[model samples]
Target: MLRGFYGAGAGMITQQRHSEMLNNNLANAQTPGYKGDNASIRSFPEMLMQAENVGAAPGGRNELIGSMNTGTYMQERTPNFAQGDTRQTENNTDMAIVQGDVPVNEEGNSGALFFNVANEDGDLRYTRNGSFAVDGEGFLTTAQGNYVLDDAGDEIFVNNEEFTVDAGGNVFDDDGEELATIDISFAAAPEDLVKEGDGLLAVPEDEDALPTAIGDDDINYDINQGFVEESNVDLMRTMSDMMESMRIFEANQTVLQAYDQSMERAVNDVGRLQ
Candidate 1:
């Protein structure tokens, strides 16, 4: 009975964490570039049930109850780590990086740059959100007034009020002429970038993969004028997971209750009779 109590307690704790991750995903269903988190469990080693009479000498073959039951522990935090679906929002400020690989400088993890999902400022902010807009100066800017960098490793200056992005992700002027390109490539490496909040990436100054390292001709990233990438969380899958977790929790609870009653009867009635 006592063993069952301990098992159930552990099981409850695991269930709580599972529910928490599920709730978080549901809350971010509408969030762009949102990633889901998942929970896992570990098991306790099997052992024989404690004998009723402590220190009693072994007389008969031990009935193996220990081999039948299992105790568990909550495992490490493993993210669901699946790519969200791509959504298309035809807003001039919206953008998405179709390329799966993000490059950074020599800083393995910390050097990553973060981008503003909403592109509040064209200036470099960390975010996975590719949505962006232009500033009053006609310069490619985020909502926050930060300048968007071009392929030349310089700020994409829009001296002309009219700007357009072509098939090759190049920005063109009013006469349908090519003005500049949004160059987001690296010279040394992209592996050094780390993931900051809002789906942006960042790198350190010491990192060699600076804009100067890459040549002008090397700038080859395509930028869409009026499109945005949508969030990728699958609703059906999340609901299914919720149901499964509920059933498992209920089953564990029933087992715990039965074990309690069995022990209660054995102690209250059997002990009294003796």
Candidate 2:
């Protein structure tokens, strides 16, 4: 009877954390390049549960399992690394990288872009969103204000000169000569792909940062200019998850309340008489 109360307490704390995760995912459902987060409760250890809280007899010793712990045993953020859908915005700066042959490797990167995107010591910083433009300094920037890179694998710096990025991710000056090219790719390993703030992703590590899955002989990524990657989250699917989470939370609450009531009556009516 006493064990029921403690068990319920554990559940209440776990449910609270689950609800928080659901709310956050729903809020960011429309965010571009955004990944969803998940939460889960740690299952009760069966061995511990089999032990008696007060020894085998009445009022012996309180075991760890019997102690009421109104604490959360839930994981706060389990990041969802699933890919988002790509939507074509048709903007010149908006670019989409699909699986294809790698043309120009790299030249450098530009400082003005979004998602804090920047080159990592000559290595290319990766992203799913291609929406970008050349800033006053002739540096390419994303819609949210971060630098875009050039082929030398450095931040592109044009110093206010007008330029165009061709279908091959090449940057051209007003005279039509190639100044530099964008160094983007989709060949990063699953472990190598990492998240930057606000839908931007950074290379998982600086060492061995080049695309290994692409094979070392030559570059193998094709660029689709004028298209942007779409968000991977589905509204209908998220809503279903939300409902399931809520239902489980309510069930936990019910069990906890029943336990509390039972414990109260046991202590007041029987314990008081003893």
Candidate 3:
């Protein structure tokens, strides 16, 4: 009976975590370059339930009764790295990187690529959000003012001129002079990248794992100038998931309450009978 209470409580806790993850996904559905996380639940090992005092009736052997489950826990929250839709802003400063061979509209090519940026502390990060601007020092920077990196892993500085980014991520001035190629990079397994907030991803510190630069003849993707990648979250699916999680949470709560009541009755009513 006590084990039942613990099991039900564990279930409630797992459902609560699931609900939180679903809510977070819903909240980020409209965020650009946002990825959704999937929650996984794992159950503790089951215990063998043996019949007590049944040894004398079963050839002096302990009688097998059944198995009882212990409890469950939230195992992991894995991020999904699926591509999102691209929106054309025609603003020249915005950009989007498309994946796979499918072109985004009729103007975009496809490959796995992301722009490199540095935080205020100069810690490197990667992002698909290309909404960039030139700062006071004429350095290309993200919306948060983080300097955008170039192919050489250095901050890109350009004069205030009408600039254009080509399909290969090369930047050019109004006079058609090439300035710098935007630092486009890729991880063999993008899912391995750790998610930092604000649509940025930090490369793992593992010495064996490092992001590679996008080289010529490599998988080509259009750096769609004047465009931004939207969040990949499916709104309808997320709404359905939220509703289902709520139902599961309620069910778990009911189970937990029932377990509590059973425990109460066992303590009060059964104790009084004894």
Candidate 4:
């Protein structure tokens, strides 16, 4: 009887979390370079049930009932690293990476690419967002003001917004003189990267920094100026998922209510003395 209540409560909590994830994806549907997350739900281990205080049956063993499931929970959320569609922003500072051949890891997952940036703390970070801006100090920066790094891991000084970036990721001034090359980092398993807010990704503390994708003979990619990669979230699918999650939540709530009513009866009516 108590297990019923616990199972229903766990189900509600799991659905609530799943709904939150779906809502977040829907909200970020238009965010540039955003990746959607998938929830991994798992059930608790089953417990073997047996008759209590039962004498030895035919084979001198206690009577066996069955296995009872404990409950379920949302285990983890994994980000989908699929490429988003590119839209032309018609801004010189905007850039979009068109990834081509990339090396696959032993897990059979293709690698991903990201632009290297440095936050205010001078810590290295990464992002797929290419909507860059030239600050007052002639340094290239992301929308959130992170300094965009070049191939040498130094802040790129593009001089002004008029700088043009070629398909090779080389920045050139109005006179076509190359200034610097944008640093693109490669992750053999991007799912391991932790999501920091504002479109930033960080490598785990135990892992080393990602390697540069540039000069890699096997990797092929091209940068397109005047464009940005849109978020990979699917609007209709997210809406459908949100609805399903809500329905599940409602069902769990109903089950919990039923369990509560049964408990009330057991405490009041069943325990009542003649």
Candidate 2 ranges with C-alpha deviation above 4 Å:
38-42, 48-78, 100-116, 119-126, 158-167, 185-196, 202-220, 270-274
Mark the regions of model 3 whose C-alpha exceeds 4 Å error after superposition: 55-60, 101-112, 216-218, 270-274
User: For residues 149-194, what per-residue lDDT tens digits would candidate 4 score against the true structure?
Assistant: 9999999997764888888899999889889999999999999999
TM-score of 1: 0.61
Q: What's the number of clashes in each of the models?
A: 45, 37, 0, 0
CA lDDT, every prediction?
Answer: 0.58, 0.59, 0.78, 0.91
On a 0 to 100 scale, what is the lDDT of residue 113 in model 3?
64
Candidate 2 residue lDDT tens string, 1-112 = 6666666667766766776777777787766665676565676654433244566677677556443334347854555545456677766666665543333313321111
Report how far residue 257 has shifted in candidate 1, in Å. Answer: 3.4
Give the per-residue Cα lDDT of candidate 4 at 50.
91
lDDT (Cα, tens digit) per residue for candidate 3, span 1-274? 7787788788878878888888988888877777788888899999998865555465565668898998889998877767889998898878888765422323242324678899888988888777788888888988889999988888987776669989878999888898999877766566667887887888678645245556645455677888888888888887887788778778877887888887788789877898
lDDT of model 2, residue 227? 68
Candidates sorted on TM-score, descending: 4, 3, 2, 1
Candidates' TM-scores?
Answer: 0.61, 0.68, 0.88, 0.95
Best-matching candidate per TM-score = 4
Error of 2 at 136 (Å): 3.3
lDDT winner: 4
C-alpha lDDT of residue 260 in model 2: 80
